[model samples]
Target: MSLVLDNVSYRYPGSTHGLHEVSLDVRAGELVAVIGPSGSGKSTLLKLVSGLTTGHTGRIVFGGQDMSAMPVHQRRMGMVFQNYALFPHLSVLDNVAYGLKLRKVPVAERHRRAQELLGIVGLSGYAQRGIGQLSGGQQQRVALARALAIDPQALLLDEPLSALDASVRGHLRDEIRAIQQRFGATTLLVTHDQEEALVMADRVAMLKDGRLLQIATPRELYEQPASRAVAEFVGLSTILPCTVCAPGRVDLGFAELHAHTGSRPVGTVLHAMVRPEHVRADPAPGSVNRLQGRTGAQRYLGALTRYDFEVPGAGKPFLAESARPAAEAIAIAPEHIRLLDL
Candidate 1:
């Protein structure tokens, strides 16, 4: 099933903060991740879709059905919260079966379904254990089982793995994506982690200050960001202000570089954006776009080393990444430089 939010707007009763006119569509059987900084309305968007909050001024549709006026229980959307809201007093099986029991399923039938879901989440043997006895990862699995028990048309996950440790979170992240794909569930995942969104979602929706900035596939979002805000938020980037010197060229004060300045007139001010990984620390002697910058600081990050290349009058150092230590100069390819409006 697909989920769509059409120009949804909301405001707090006495405050001026809330989601602005936002529109998004999660395709059928596709996982769309909503990511942004704190107070960016990530959680509010999830709450509105799940029908936990109301009084929005737009349509919320599911599977071609207008669900704007539908009650929470009738929305047929399953939600997994960050806190893993499992009943501590209930055993794993009972916790997973709670939703089924609420719908009046027979004891034997609900238990059978619960057991099946537990097995799917890799908690079959722990079904009889108390929630408090399980680790954070295990508890989250039970919470997932409980949400899946309802067999929702759309699965809503609000930072579901945020509470787990790094190691456990990494494992559970893969597990959740596998399970989601296995069920072919239409999912809307709310997260503040960029890596999580990029790795698990088919497309990413970036929100800022209650507004939807951009929605695109991870590759598109990373490599071809729509604007400077989108470029800076999605990943590490060095944005340099410049003026269009020609049809496909920009002057960065210190040096003029070739870029994809599409149809912009000469002397038009713009920003040249490039990712750290795209900056070559040591280019061949006769390479293009070469800049002389003394290496300042270097940080070893396991597989790659991050270097700060400080050019004489560039205002700020250019960040570059390579597998080894950086030399005195760096080069940036014209194709790797993305031009954006200032």
Candidate 2:
């Protein structure tokens, strides 16, 4: 089912920032992730869609009907929370079938449906195990199976695998994505972890101060952010102030280099953003955009090593990623640089 939010705005009576005219759309069978820092309205947005919070301006349409008038129970949304939210005393089968039981499904049929879902989630033989007897990751699986038991039109996940260890979380992230795709279910996931959002979602919606900043594919969000905050949220990018010299170039204090102006005319103040991977270390002598900066920090990431270097126009040190540590002075190519409105 497709979900749409049009000009939705919400605010608690005493709060300063609540959602501010946020709009987003999730196509059928697509997984969209809502990611932001704390109090950015990621969870609140989900709550509004799920009918947990009401009395908001604007319309929420899902499955071709207005959702503002619907209650949570009638929304047909299966929700999996961060803590799993299972009944401690219930067996795995019973937990998965709880929704069916509420609707007065026959005892035998509910068990059959629950067992089938457990198999789909790769827990075929654990039907009799109690929630307390399972590991955290296993509990999460049960939560997912339970949510899908009703064959919901939309699935809402709130950090579904966050309670598990790093390795378990990594594995379950793939599992959840696989299961979601296999079922062709429309899903909305809310998470603070950037990797989860970037890896799992078809499109990522970034929020800031209760406002929707940008919604785009992962590559677009990472490669070309709409604003400085969006750039910082996605990943590390070296931002340096520049004066627009012309349509395709900007002037740094010590040197002028090619940059993307987006047709902003001369004398406009802009910020040049170059990703760490684009920052070339010890380029050929006399290469364009070369600057003498002191390298002070060394960070050994698993796939890439990062070194911080002080650039001329940038007040703060900028990072460069390489196979190994780099020299102090570095040069970033103009083609790899993107100019932002700042």
- TM-score for each predicted model, relative to the true structure: 0.98, 0.96
lDDT (CA) per prediction: 0.92, 0.89
For model 2, the local distance difference test gives 0.89
Model 2: residues with Cα > 4 Å off, grouped in runs: none
lDDT tens readout by residue for model 1, 202-227: 99999998999999999999999988
- Per-residue lDDT for 1-342 in model 2, tens only? 789999999998887778999999999999999998899999889889989899899999998899898889899999999888999988999999999999899999999999999998899999999899999999999999999998899999988877789999898999999999988889999998899999999999999999999999999999989998998889888887889987887987666887767768899998888899998888777888777877778888899888888766566887789886557567777778888886
| List of clashing residue pairs for candidate 2 | none
RMSD of 1: 0.9
